[model samples]
Target chain A: DAGITQSPRHKVTETGTPVTLRCHQTENHRYMYWYRQDPGHGLRLIHYSYGVKDTDKGEVSDGYSVSRSKTEDFLLTLESATSSQTSVYFCAISEKDPQETQYFGPGTRLLVL
Target chain B: SQQGEEDPQALSIQEGENATMNCSYKTSINNLQWYRQNSGRGLVHLILIRSNEREKHSGRLRVTLDTSKKSSSLLITASRAADTASYFCATVVSNFGNEKLTFGTGTRLTIIP
Candidate 1:
């Protein structure tokens, strides 16, 4: 609905392998976020970007990293993926305004074997 | 740690019934928002109630916020089969620049025909 799309809708990889998920938005929103959803864990923030080249860590940023070199694309990479990182990842974008509602992408499901 | 906790981890209701879910948070919030996820898909923004607002409504959805109790509730009137999904509540804390949202574990709703 927000012109947001996440690449690699589903993936299964062996442990210790590196994986990168991409989120692209046509809306050119100023804020972008990456979150992971797991059983009994709800949705936890991994990383977020306020603008291009400006990013910050979140609650679960241990094994994940994010980059936003441009306004339209935000990338999440799991360096040496682990089994604990197996979950559904969602990307969201919102305006700079604090009261603006966030729009989410379709999500990517990753399984680490 | 999770910022918000939703009550009634799972709910079952008939198609014409009303479904209600409650969320409680620990810290002060600037606003509270609701989101819905359809199975394996991404989450969709449903409604948002600002700290200054007491109640808000959209279509068949009604949201009420009580900052004094640090809690919020979502009510879906005349819920349909399509409304069956996982509902989550997110809170925006009173921080400066980035308004990072923390989401609840979610309440799974099953609509019986």
Candidate 2:
């Protein structure tokens, strides 16, 4: 189970609308990440947090933002969803460093039409 | 751009047979990790090999790293239907420190019963 959970397992929304996905972890891991999976592109990192209020952009971070106000919660938001943003979003956490093994949540399937 | 590339985009094998997948990266890395994603689900960490290590094993899975070639291989012995999934190799660039991982395009393995 990875002791991780993501809200709204599946969602369908129209383009230009704002969307937010939540990830909660019980492991108290210091590092959390958000990634999107797409066909032919693999998994691309969107954002990550090394500590509370400490977040950074990842490989494909455009139009996406993340926040970590508490150790157990991380949220990813899209200011204006786009069709290209329709993908399976996954949340992962590592106990120590990013190089360490990461535990992933069940994932959220978002469809932006 | 630091993403790894997995070889044999897809593979089909019968249950009980061994399956092998290879991954090649472009830059030096501190560590290599393998993850598995079943259909409609998030990924699960499988194994990790350090840059200084040549090989590692856990249960029926074996991982090998060749820094000279910037490549790695994952081997699964006595594969079963449950082992059917997409496998990805991720790398943490040596120069980038421990921040985020760059993932490969992945290899889809189908086990025939």
Candidate 3:
């Protein structure tokens, strides 16, 4: 409902394979964030971008990387997929402050075998 | 470790009854927000309560924050069948302009229709 869409709503890949998930927003928000949701572990932030080409790591950024080359597109990449990386990934956008309410996309379900 | 922990992983109630969910955190926070997520879908922002504010109301939703106890609660009155979903509470902590949000595992609410 926020004009945000995540590509490849469902994906299954083998371990050690490279996988990239894309988040596109039409709101032209300045802040974009990536999070992963797992059972019993809640949602953990993977990475976020404040502006074009500006990014930062989050609490669970161990095996994930993000890039925001443009205002509307934010990409999350897993250089090598692992079984532990299997989870539902969500992308969120905020107009300005990180402390404000965020709008989320539909989310992508990834499975690593 | 700053993640909020929501009580009662799952709850079931009648459609017209009220549902209350509690969240507790371990650190000082700048603000707290509640979100709702339908199965296999993304999260939607519900309400927000700042640390300095004791309570805030939005429609049928009421959010209360107690900084002294490091806890927050969400109350939804006159629940509807469509209100059945997983509710999450996220905490925002800031340190030197770097703010981080940690989400709880979420409480799954089912309204008996």
Candidate 4:
């Protein structure tokens, strides 16, 4: 269970609107990641943060942005929602070991109309 | 591009039967991990097999890695209805400080109880 939780388990927004999903963890892991799952394409990385104020782009980071101001919280924002951004977003955390097993949050389902 | 691609997009079997899923990767990896995602739930880490290791076992799950073939397989013995879920294989590609995981589309397993 990893003590990870995602807020707004479901959301519906219109195109061009702003949307932000939150991921909170109690494990205090150093690495947090955002991923989107879609049919046929599987799960694609959106963005990830290694520590406070340190972030990096992932496989599919074009329409998304992320910020990590604290160890327990990571935010993923869609500046302007698009139909293509509709997917189930999952948050995961891992310890300092790069090869360690990752713990995942419940996930947030977002829909863009 | 995805590092791993799972074979058999979908599968079905009796509750007591054994189930097997295979994953193939295009490049070298530090380790390969298997995860299970229940419907509408977060993914749960099942097991991890490092590139140096040929096989590993966790409970009823057996994972085998063949680095030469760039492939891996997960075998679940005596399956149950609770085991019905989408199974994914993720590969950790380590590049110095830049390390990230690439996940496969997954195999949807349906256990007929």
Q: Which lDDT tens digits does candidate 4 get at residues A1-113? A: 78999999999999999999999999989999999999987788889998999999998999899999999999999999999999999999998864679899999999999
- Stretches off by above 4 angstroms in model 4 are none
TM-score of each: 0.96, 0.97, 0.98, 0.98
Worst 10 residues of 4 chain A by lDDT: A95-104
Give the RMSD in angstroms, all C-alphas superposed, for model 1. 1.2
Candidate DockQ scores, in order: 0.71, 0.83, 0.88, 0.77
Model 3 Cα lDDT, one tens digit per residue, B1-113: 64699988999999999999999999899999999999999999998888889999999999999999999999999999999999999999878899977899999999999
The model with the greater lDDT, 3 or 4, is 3
Q: Quality of candidate 1's docking, in CAPRI categories?
A: medium
Q: Is candidate 1 or candidate 4 better by DockQ?
A: 4
RMSD of 3: 0.8
Interface RMSD for every prediction, one decimal?
1.5, 1.0, 0.7, 1.1
What is the C-alpha lDDT profile of model 2 across B2-94, one tens digit per residue?
469999899999999999999999888889999999998889999999999999999999999999998999999999999999999999886
Ranking by lDDT: 3, 4, 2, 1
Question: Lowest-lDDT window of 10 residues in candidate 2 chain A?
Answer: A36-45
- Candidate 2 segments whose C-alpha is farther than 4 A from its true place: B96-98
lDDT of 3 at A6: 98
Rank by DockQ (best first): 3, 2, 4, 1
Docking class of 2: high
lDDT string for model 1 (B1-113, tens) is: 77899988999999999999999999999999999999878889999899999999999999999999999999999999999999999999977765778899999999999
DockQ score for model 2 = 0.83
